[model samples]
Target: MMEAVKRFVGPKWRQYLAASLASYGSLCTGMSMGWTSPIFPQLRGPNSPLAEEPTLQQESWIGSLLVLGGLAGPIITVPLSRYIGRRWLVMGSNLPLLLGWLLAGVASDLPTLYVARLMWGCATGMQFATVPLYIGEIAEDHNRGALSSLFLLFINVGFLLAYAIGPFTSYWGLTACGGILSLFYVPFTWFIPETPFFLVYKDRNTEASDVLKKLRGTSKEAVQAELEGLQALVAREFKEEPKISDLWATRGNVKALGICVFLAMLLQLSGIDVLLFYMEELLVKVGTKISASDGTIIMGAVQVVTSCITPLVVDRLGRKLLMWTTSLGLTIFLGLIGVYALLDSYYNYDMGSWAFLPLLCLIIYMILFTLGVGPVPWILVAEMFPVKTKCLASGIASFMCWLAGFIWTRFFRDVAASYGIYTAFWVLAVCCGVGFVFSATLLPETKGKTFDEIQDMLNNRSKEPKPVAV
Candidate 1:
């Protein structure tokens, strides 16, 4: 495994560095724009008179509009990657992001903030689609999983940083810090390269070879071998142009699509967003009278640490097995939290020992999710679809992901308000159970497979065992 990684990373260190930097750009946007959610209850809590602040409510509305704007990209991202290439899209999309950040930082009203967030979401979604597509295309088969997993790790880092800043800036102010952080995009565009696959897609074979050679710094023979592998993978995937109809017309792809949607939905409804959006309230209910501010920071810390464990082990455990184990474990933990909440409520919130249990259970649930569904699904999205199906499938799949995010964010507040925190957790536990069974039965292992070979595995064309690298 070390030899295989060296063969790719030896010559391709520059390309790897560029890709990693661009990935940071995407994640910084994700982390910064949404930092308020995790700590919203603290900054504008029900207990605080500032709860009436239009700013916090508007931020939620803006988040919805932002997701709506992102939904538009599926129409163009496929053809855009095919025509203009992924690198230029990455370069060009930053313009809107920059503008959005400027507008948001300066905004004083709901309307202005809404428009800013909408535009930011569109550009940010483009980055999300393009970054992984670009990274997966550039990485040599032997090292792609580890490299792609880095994107997930850095995203959590961004989340950790953003959450840290949210509370930090509350002491300082939002506008100043947000504006300063937004400028990171300028250097991102300056540094990253166009994906070699995009060049190949346009029939710029020589440029593609040059990019590949730069990224795969080994002997001439090894470089040639790497390019040949990529070319073969691309050739196999692109034999047919993917159509929207293919989603339903092909049974195997449809099954894979269904599984992706299920996983995406499960990720959201499993109360991950609730944990993010309402950590303070949940923590208070369960027994800790800790400030919402401190609770948000603790939640962020858990997320960052737990997410670190996934990248280290995901390539080794294989995707399906990881999902199976964690989904089941998460369900049990969530159920425990629900029981604790119910029991505590009956005791008039006086059972301090029982109250802390929900907080402890939630931490365990977050760790389990980070180890499996959090990063693995994104990696699967990058690897599962063929070139033909990749655009629409990814678009639809991503839409499902954000849609689920939207639902959880919008409804969890109301649910916690009406049903009580205990019942809310029970609902999440049910979803986790569904996710575990679906994963164990329907999701296949895609570890150690080439991008094209994964498409083949999805289609069931090659059944002979593909070797799993430890």
Candidate 2:
């Protein structure tokens, strides 16, 4: 077993371990997102864990509070990362994550649940702001997409866990499981050192050179060359560390931030979060042939399977192509779902065999979603910004991403409740069509490109002769 593992892991395993450990926070976030999928029914039904059953409005709050708290976390992460560094921040995040789960595990009332979910969201948002920036610094251009896309892979596994396990586990039992998972991040962190870019930026060149050697598994000369490149980039970019205002300083920065913000909005407006959080409820309404619980589990399993394929193909396929094609694909698939929702909900039609249409539509929807907008936008956020404004820009973009999620998930239930779910589905389908147009017209291909190249492309300066990133 050890021989086989060594054969697979090879010498550059430190970078992978570092990226995966940092992304452990995403697993906790996924559990929080997926928790509502199976548990929503129980929360509002006879199996209620709270003192009283939650109404639809209350349930929306229950679902959106974590997202609402997402808005708060990025605000904290930007400044905190300056002092603690990405590795430490990623490690310490487990405290709040574990606390959130413990609160859920013992909660007896609605307010406690709200606070717990919000804490979960805050912890997730912090990771979102830090992990990608950390990964981008550590990974080589050749495999950056594959490594960064692990963010989605791990989170989707968390999604699968909740959907698969939530149905059978008691309410508190599931929370306990999540809290246990949160503790693993610390041990993972112990195995990996701080990112070489971060160490260089902090003026610890000796340590940075040593760490880079370990992460790159290269010889002294090669490591020294790599270290020098990072030193120049860090010296130039960090002469004065970037502020939120600095993101708007250069046209490249402005364009990069805009593109990232737009993509972030596009990702959430696709309404993937609504499905993750309300899969059981949505299927129950769709009247699928399979039980909603079964459908939710299958959908989640599909996410994990499909997500695994993304990291393999993302670097090969290129970012813009996958994003453009999948955006259109989502537009088509989501429209099909809207049609079934229209027939079933708006017309009050009852059919025998056609009941499988929504289920089929959603299955394909998850496929396209997981392949493209679901994961690619986050990668783009990590790629587009330069090191100078990376933390600030990333925090801004993540804030927009979660703010959009909160808006979409908060009102989706109410929209479905008010005008029938068909109305909500149709709206998302239209927005996805817009996303398709955006990707084709504006989204730059980040495949095999460095951050400087990406920023230049965003600013229409890629063709001009210039030095590589300092």
Best by TM-score: 2
RMSD of 2: 3.3
Candidate 2 TM-score over all chains jointly: 0.93
Candidate 1 structure quality by residue, lDDT tens digits, 238-354: 777666897777656776787777787778777775566455557776555556566666666887676556666887899999998999998898888777777777556566645
lDDT (C-alpha) at residue 429 in model 1: 84
User: Model 2, range 1-470, lDDT digits (tens) per residue?
Assistant: 64564567687776777788788778877988899987877776676778788889999998898888888778987888888787887776777788789889888899899999989888888777777777888888766766787888889989989998899977877888888888787787676678888788788999888888888877767898888898888777777756678888788778778888888888899998888898988887766778988898889888888987887766679888998899898888788877877877678788557888888889999998888787787777667776666677778888999999999989998898888787888889998999889889887788888766776776777475788897
| Model 1 error, position 8 (Å) | 14
Each prediction's whole-model lDDT (CA): 0.69, 0.82
Q: RMSD to native for every prediction?
A: 5.2, 3.3
What's the true lDDT of residue 73 in model 2? Answer: 73
Q: Could you tell me the lDDT of residue 132 within candidate 1?
A: 76
Which pairs in model 1 have colliding backbones?
11-217, 12-215, 286-355
Candidate 1, poorest ten consecutive residues by summed lDDT: 42-51
The candidate that wins on lDDT is: 2
